[model samples]
Target: MLERSTKIESPGVLKAGNPNKSLASWQGRKTEIAQIQQWLTDKNTFLIGIEGIGGTGKSMLATKIYDEIADFPKRFWADVSNGAGFSDLARQVLSEFGFPVPEQETQLVEALVGCLRSGQFLLIIDNLESLLQPDRQWGSLFYGDFFQAWVEDGGNSKVIVTTRERPELKGFEWLTLKGLQVDEGVALLTVLGIRGDLTQFVELVDGHPLLLRLVADLLKEEYSQDPDLSRLADLGLGNLRQLLTDSQVVGIHHRKNVGMVLVLDASFNRLNELQKALLLNISVYRGAVDSAAAVAMLPGSSAPEIEEELRNLVKRSLLVDKLNGKRRFDFQPLILAYVRYQAGDQSEAHQKAIDYYRSIAKQPPWKTKDDVKEYLEIFDHFYQLQDYNSAFDSIRICNDFLTLRGYYVDKVELYGQLVSKWEEIGARENRNYQAALIFLGNAYDSLGQYQRAIEFYQQSLEISREIGDRNGEGKSLNNLGNAYNSLGQYQRAIEFFQQSLEISREIGDRNGEGASLGNLGNAYNSLGQYQRAIEFHQQSLEIKRDIGDRNGEGASLGNLGNAYNSLGQYQRAIEFLQQSLEIFKEIGDRNGEGASLISLGNAYNSLGQYQRAIEFLQQSLEISKEIGDRNGEGASLGNLGNAYNSLGQYQRAIEF
Candidate 1:
């Protein structure tokens, strides 16, 4: 049995109080607060949903309600805006309750529901809109299941969820939080120390909380010396308000957003050059922006200068300072859209971001998750600049890392986009286009879509031959052989491998020759030609050593072990497999590591060491799941079952 750790540590601190202190001093929302308090106190109401548009002060209202609800024995706040998923939230909750969280998704959900039912806890899930799917549904079935369970079953606990979009769920009171009342908006302006009769100004902004705050901040800074309501035209509000009012005839949605855009535009015009440049440049990023990235985006600006500018933007409400684990900056969705709109034709900025990310990356075969993330950004920047060739090149450089990490679905999508772009530009004959086809084929092969894989590989082969590219032709042949091998067509695979080997030798491509030999060995092993497979694997191993290809050498060694194991040489197989495992670990090739573990488990099982085999297979199963290798996961489960069956533990075997 696997000795699973039961220790539980919180991924984030669960302080049981109002987390949004920034809005503590702000007034308004008394009526909203009272209604939410009633829902919290109501025994029948288990879930309270607060929904609104972007700038309507939903979070602020939730914070107020949270602070006022002091009767609950437990309170937990989770901010989902930083891209935390359902599992992350569950882990935090379970840890807070001091319960061990299971690794499996279903088990985790069950544990969380049990915890929620066990107490009268108050849970506030903020920015739930961030976790909602693009189609306005729950992003995960687990989310739906968890919430549904909470509603169907009686629980002492109450849940508060705040979102820009309302989720369609039953057994809940939905509060459509709108803009503040005119009196509340005027009070906010007054509190901000704006010395004016701001009733007309507040009414014009439709009592939008964030817009009122932003306009006040701008006025406080720019017009502090004069501080008169008559000089509002100096800040462009006169013409801007007219434009927004006239545009209300377009649509209600447009009318709602036009006020925000006009306010953002007025605020943007007041920024200094560096501040404007920083916002425009960082707007290209799809996620949060740290100071380091901010500084990189603006060349000739020192770190201190950039930090000051970032703070200035945060103060001006143009950027949100996300003080989670790190002090990073992000924009509200509307703000990001506004800045990106203002940054039309930001190809130069995108290129700068690309260069900065590339500069920080370690040379290819990126080992860290952070490196892969940066490469993803680089690819996006290239795509934004319409440099599809460079974008695909970045994808090519990170292809192995992506594969090892089980990013096949994402890889397929990226390559598909690149292929469509190439076809659009009539560049199907380009080398990158051929590479994209091969990449798509490889992704499909990894995903077990062998027929689709064959289609793309065939297209790549045709393109390679048409362009007279021998190396690409050899690669296509090798990939096709691998796909056939996966499909159990060993003889067909061998024929493709033989052709690939011939091309490699003719082109003097030693690396390609080694890959072809290794693939041939795999096909022969599948055919039960143990001695012949060993011979081919040995040749491939020698070439890998000569070329210093550690990953390939490890793969060849594992293949040799597999062949030996098939010949009943269990001890020899163990030694070779162990060496292969070590190499894969050193190279950070998680996919290879999992394969070697599975082979080792099989060898141990052959020796009748069922307990040891179970341990190895379990480890392999974890790695397979981590790297998204569905085939490896199935193999690990099957191997473990065989070991359990050998021990006559039929029930345990069936569980596997």
Candidate 2:
């Protein structure tokens, strides 16, 4: 038998109406109630563990148990949110249950147990995980003898503990509570004037009380109309997630304290400018990007400093990711949206990309002149994408290379067109129609503007041939092949590819050889010659591999996979895509990886593996959105819709 303490009623604090109070007029959680009541009534069980997700009304559940069990001599409530030691745990429980506080760890549990044995008390321990916290020396505070002693000997009254984690306590009856069912969630929502059908929604989230309440809050705030259940059922929580920003009221009691939402704001205020930028920069990754990739995205930081900050985020639970693995770290979606809103004001990402492009532009041209054409090529890509700010900035920086030193015909043409867009000019240079004609031709060919493409390629090819530049002539032929292929003129495309291949092989340019081979593969693909297309692509892949051109090899592999897919060889297609995906990730080619994911998802969709298809497509959509690839994102979204539709989840199929 255990000792006992003086009789006392469970403390009934009348501070429920206080503005900052966490107390609620609780109602549901019947299962949890029954489980704990049984645990308390059982004589064999010494420890009772109550577990639930955040905001699942865990505190209220614990509070109710404290209030209801009246016959115990004393009742104590210990908040273990900070993780307590055995000594601290005994002291807090004793204090809350109206037992005298013991002065030292050696006598703390004995004093409490003696009081209990004397027929005085029961203890309801709050935040059970908090008792796991250690002192500054980094040692466990409550793992051994005392914990066993409390349960085995402190007999007369029972002890109950609540935690978010599944604490492995011996002789403890663990009761895990997830979120409410569909009906319960809806009731909770309806009570707050929130609206949603939620009938067809796949409940991936464990009905965690906080998240349910958040969804309910979002429904009330954003989608208040359209009574047809079909419309409501069609939408998923993802839509709600998008609409639910930081300021909006979240889950169950939408009016309750939004303390957790403010955690990021406090975290932001605590960090310096550099740390803020570093954190925000890393947040833009496709998935849990490894530390090395994060460093690559941000150029200036040292490894040790970044590692320290990353460790800080992990400890604070701001950035959740496995410390090891390839796709290891991700900022929580809710947190990421907030960070994106904040980062737009501060990051120098655009400026950095521009600077890097300029540095690459400064590299010595192999056969071409110092025309700064490489920079123009990159600059215009950004320009056409409406990344105008970076384009304009780069155009300003490399105005020199675009002018006097530029002589390569393609570059000269690009320079003329590029300078024509600028409003400012000190010494206006004459436009060389010939060079503009050449560059514009090549650009049109690259863009699949075949008529425009053909016109430019013809013009450039004639000039290069006249100038005795066989290499330029060969490049023009390659563009001619690409343009013809786009126009469904496979015969013409093959002719051009053949000529280009001959010239490339004659010149011993391995890169040019791979390009010509890839071009021929494209021609074959266009003509529906699946086997021939794959063979050409494999030839291109070999050349790319030998030349150490990872980009070219991945492209060839992707093309080969597309061929296999078209032929209904799903397994082979998947294999090729997986290979391409590996290379893309290894080389940090997010855009390539996104495309591969889409292709793989499409293959899976064809095989009727809808869940896996949607999974991969969803990942693809996220990656594309992160990399600013709207086209890829849209394609993935459409595929995801199809997947849901095929699964008979019609309501979740489409979103306008």
Candidate 3:
């Protein structure tokens, strides 16, 4: 029984790395390979890096070179993207070279480098960009140092790395790989068993290897069912270009590659109903997905059946499968873009995805990274369904988690989409539309983009006034006041706060009234009016306590603490801030807790208690980092600097 289960499971695990066995037949890049071969044989060059965007065949070319180089005494290959780090690569090299592998990372790397320096070894590192920073620098210092040593001291041993970005290192011959020539593309299609002359098709795609292969596979599949080339003939270059233009896939647009979009559209069109449906449904996913998730997206489909379909899609070049600890499937960027564009009117599919993700998500107050990720999927589905209210609700539930956890940019993007959709539909006066504008404004405000925040706030205010929504009007006015205060325009902020206060009073919205009072306090505090700030904050605190708004009460307490600290009442400020911190902790408001800690740190620093101030600031920094609150993190660092400076530890202050 165990053996049977294992056999059944083994087929689903797609092995990764070193596609040498699978890529037996190859075409094109002969010129490029010869140049690389020359570089490899050159005693002066010890390293070569092939750089290109995805689907340009960087790995394929590297594998081809590896196969061609039989004269090398030793050859090794590692796919860096598939969980293979520098240490893993080192271990492979040491073990293969008959050297005893060291357990320590430094020792292992040293051993590998020593072995390479002593022999004629060739190492191929695939997807090297995975180990590189966005700025084209090595992500790991160990890898960088190892490579530098190889280039400087390795005798006769050569290393080739394939990446999307060229690493910032000297002593390496760089190859900026491009798509195949038209003739080469034609030959490749023929090798893939594509019938008919494909010179025009190849030219249309600009000889992009992956697009050609996809189109060829799709054509071959169609030909297998019916030996008719009429369909291929009918899709002339003109029609193909028109189809690509009409699709409007963002990836294709960015590449400005007419052939890519056309080929994807043709391939997508040739898929059977089930294949098309599966592709469209799975397009909702952002990244790698397992069989279970794929099965969930296709309701009423058996796991075995779905797995088989997934394999079929992989064979057709619609999906790419890999084993990164577990079997998963993904798409190339262009294909994902094309599929998303075609995924319209798939409400049932979107709902199925929503249900699947929701079923696996933890209940609210999402405690794990996975829970937050799942909610993002739910939000996406709701947005696709044009269910703006539910989508906004999803965002609201995870607002603090998103804001504090470095997902504020993502939150802003989601709100931008909502606003765009509402405007597209001309629903300017809709409550959700106004709410989305306010939410976007608040996001910008939190990010310190005060000008953008004011723009959104003004839009929301206009919409609220137009719709006679007094509560929304008050909220928008309060938000506008906050934005102005952030910009240091205290009087302008006060004017907005007064209007919001009047609206809140007229509508009997106790929460809005409290929020407006708090904004007034903040503006006054900014202007150095400590006594007036304290009075307003006290009023806000009373209203919040009456309404049982614990979060609001904490904010008011923190505001009063700041006002007292400004007034040089250090001990009194600490007392209020401590209370505020406790309330925030009890209510699980990490952002508020961070704010209170910073206030306490400032008060202690003012009192000449530098060490005590540092302790509080350090805690604030930790919380800020934990919650992804960049602004809070900056504030904590600046305050820590002040405290250290007060203690005459100028170096420590500078470091902070």
Candidate 4:
């Protein structure tokens, strides 16, 4: 009854050649093939769905099984990589069976079903997901349920499908293909003559067959130029990781390989306008995005509307559920990069991402686990964008929060990136340029790279002097003092601090004066001038309190407590440290609280109060662990061990 497009071929196994022999070779999946074989040969089995993301070799596997199966009298295969109408599909299938395709749809359906019922046949449809639709109506038929009757009749014919999505039909065998195994991946890489720690290369690409093949080809070409593998080896993990994660690389193809851009584009083109927009929106994130972020990024759409679109995209295999049932989604790296490139005019989406992340980064000092999670996401997005101006602005806005929260490495990375951009943009003398230098210096200072810290500080100071900015000069001078103090050049640190103090007093900048006094006190304490340290700290505390700088006041109290402890005045130290701890708690400063707790523990230990020391150290450790403060955690652990040792509990100390 079906209108056949061509005559059927004689019954025999389908012959094949490995596609893209240079880039792809069929290495493994014998287990999967045997599983499909077991199901197809079973009398009760009616349908099989081979599902995976693009480039996982679904089509290849389907063809392999079709060739291996021996008993089918008639065989049919359709390359529906693009969407096809039901009539076209029926005609193609009928033509393969040496039957004429009928003009009438009802007659064709009846004839096809009758043919399958009477004789043995094998039908293989590749990319079946493309043929499905949300509405399901192809022409007086629901695509989702069209195969139900054929499958239910218990016919001799068996159907096998390869698709990117799970078919909505019931009672079908489903096999989801993942990445290739390590040995197989390595064999593929070897075909291209690209060398590395074969395991790490496979692991880097997560053993995704297409990715491994594609990246290996690129690296192979690069290696061909010199045959010196060390060039690639020099890239190291950081650079290599960046290169592999870039979706742009997947779009490349040699004469042998078809680019992933085309594969992903097929999936992307099937999406509706809103679904396409949503895909683009999510691609801006560095990693998985939760439902709330999705809703926030697209304010024009309601939450329900966004959710519905997300589900549809996931069903279409354009988006994936990163955290199952938790409502977080992600795209495959190549697919995301492809979608971002295809979705023209993405400035609006990029701006939306920037605003959302900026708001998150500006929130109160990231106290909770959720807060830290959100900031990490924000940092990831910023790092991925690599927009120097935006990154610098965010750093300035959240400077104190980043410093207090121990995000110094991130700061250093961001500043380093900003400096590169400044050089690229040729803005060596701008006001923001000096500010970036100063911040970078401060980051280096915090990391104990005092010499590097002084280099950047001096650069900032030079710029400020040329521009006649007294405030900038004073800040840079104070930063230089901090660096010198860290390097044990106390006299040099004092001279810089004295200059900063003079400028602060001359310019009537009370905040700068307090900061300078604090630096002087720290330098004197490090030099063993405990009484002089106390004098400067007292002055700094009075000024901070008078100026209503509660954060600064807390810092001064903590410093005073540390100075007193160094002076062997345990009582005085405990009193000041307790006050500092209370202030930090009131202000929701977990880092400050942890530091004060450690100080209190040390002061108590000095007084032979080992039990009190343990108690304080335990609390400090908990706070550090909660806030992800690694430096604080290390200090707390060390102090706890000391307290245990003092109590003659050597085993407990060793355990700690």
Mark the regions of model 2 whose C-alpha exceeds 4 Å error after superposition: 1-439, 442-448
Q: Please give, for residues 1-656, the per-residue lDDT of candidate 2 as tens digits.
A: 00011110111111111012133324467777888777667777767777754556666677776766556645656543322334445545565656675323345557767766666466666544433322212123333455577677867677776665554446778787656666666555456554345533314333445544444433332345632323333433234333333456555333222333433454566566766876777654333445665565566888677766676565444565453323245553345556766766433553444454455566532221224544553455454444544554544454433222222222323333443443133112212333444455544443345696687678667767776767776788988888888889899989999998998898888899899999999889889999999999999999999999998889899999999999999999999999999999999987789999999998998999989988889889988767545456667888888889888888889650
Candidate 1 on 570-600: residue-level lDDT in tens?
9999999999999999999888999999999
Ranking by lDDT: 1, 3, 4, 2
Please give the distance, in angstroms, between residue 403's alpha carbon in candidate 3 and its true position after superposition: 1.7
Residue pair clashes in candidate 1: none
Q: Highest lDDT among the candidates is held by which one?
A: 1
Q: What C-alpha lDDT do the candidate models reach, one value each?
A: 0.79, 0.59, 0.76, 0.70
Model 3 agreement with the true structure over 87-193: per-residue lDDT tens digits = 44665678777776543344555787889888888888876665565566654436788888887786788888887667788888999888788888878877777
| Ranking, TM-score, top scorer first | 1, 3, 4, 2
Question: Which 10-residue window in model 4 sums to the lowest lDDT?
Answer: 1-10
Off by over 4 Å in 3: 1-26, 30-179, 182-208, 211-277, 283-287, 333-344, 362-371, 585-588, 625-630, 650-655
Q: How many clashing pairs does model 4 include?
A: 6
Give RMSD to native, each candidate.
8.6, 27.2, 12.4, 24.0
Check candidate 3 and list the clashing pairs. 404-627
Please state the error at residue 536 of candidate 1 in Å. 7.5
What's the TM-score of each model vs. the native?
0.69, 0.37, 0.65, 0.56
